[model samples]
Target: MNTVLRLATAACLAVSGYLHAQLYVGGYRVIPLIGPSFLVQASAAFAVAVLVALGGPFLLRLAAAALAAGALAGFVLSRTTGLFGFSEQGFQPAPEALLSVLAEAAVLVLVAVTLYRVRRGTRTVRA
Candidate 1:
């Protein structure tokens, strides 16, 4: 279970890092409250990195779960916002919104599954 969690955490970080790096190139601004100049791609990457760096038995599970949820939301918003015909900025979804949504959905599933397993293990321990 720990191995799976570590793998999932690493995967999420990698995915987020890739996405963030793209945003940096694209010049997309980060969502407000998180950071002004912070890009979505960078934020996701940072979160994943933090989790992996802070891997402790006590908080690793919670951090992993939060990162998974954050990734899921980021993916969803990135996809759905463009469905309404938003202007194409440097970081905007290209071609179509559906593609972004689909991509995000896939990422979400991968992260979610890993988080779910971690959660289940925690629950089993508690019980």
Candidate 2:
């Protein structure tokens, strides 16, 4: 169960990371702060995903969840108030924007479920 959850979460993160990397190389690598942020996000996401997949550690799950949440937050900010003075209207990046958002969301849910199951199993059944 844990392995399944971890793999799922890692898959999600990998998807998100790929999208970010594609975006960065597609032309976003010149948006000042936004460009650099994208690169960092991509790298970190990949690294975390590998770690989580290799070992379903609680800390790794937490890190993965945080990464996904951060990506989602960045997406919202970029579409809403704006991220690093950059704002996109109505998912301007086409499928990448939407797909990445979905992937990140899934990572969050998967991580939460994984963590919940781990904690639940550790409790003593007060029968």
Candidate 3:
């Protein structure tokens, strides 16, 4: 179960990274601010994916959690209130956006679970 969850988390991170990297092609024009932000996001996602695949150190898991939180916040702000003067087309669902959101959400859940398990294990060991 642990291995499966780890693999799943890594897969989700990879998918999320790809989606973020894709924004460079045409997404930058739609939201210029996204250019640098997306690049950073993609890089972080891939890095965290690697870390998760390797069985996560505490620092790595913490970084992954931060990245996931930032991504989620960016998605919500961009879609709703708009970020840096850039707003999505509308409230209607877009396939690509939905997929990205789902991938990020999955990463968030998986990473959280991994962190919880790690903390629990530490407590057991210390006790």
Leading candidate by TM-score: 2
Q: Model 3, range 1-127, lDDT digits (tens) per residue?
A: 7788787888887787777787655456356677788888988889888988898765665676677778878888987888988667542235657777788788778878877887899999999
Question: What residue runs in model 2 are displaced by over 4 Å at the alpha carbon?
Answer: 125-127
TM-score of 2: 0.94
Clashing pairs in 2: none
Task: Give the per-residue lDDT digits (tens) of candidate 1, residues 6-58.
Answer: 55555655555555456545554443432222265456556655666566463
Q: Given candidate 1, what's the lDDT at residue 83?
A: 23
Clashing pairs in 1: 20-41
Clashing pairs in 3: none
lDDT for model 3, please.
Answer: 0.76
For all predicted structures, in order, the TM-scores are 0.48, 0.94, 0.81
Using TM-score as the yardstick, the better of models 2 and 3 is: 2
Poorly placed runs, candidate 3 (over 4 Å): 89-93, 123-127
C-alpha root-mean-square deviation, candidate 2: 1.3
Error of 3 at 35 (Å): 1.4
**Stretches of candidate 1 exceeding 4 Å from the true structure:** 29-44, 78-127
Go through the candidates in order and give each one's C-alpha lDDT. 0.51, 0.90, 0.76
Error of 1 at 87 (Å): 6.5
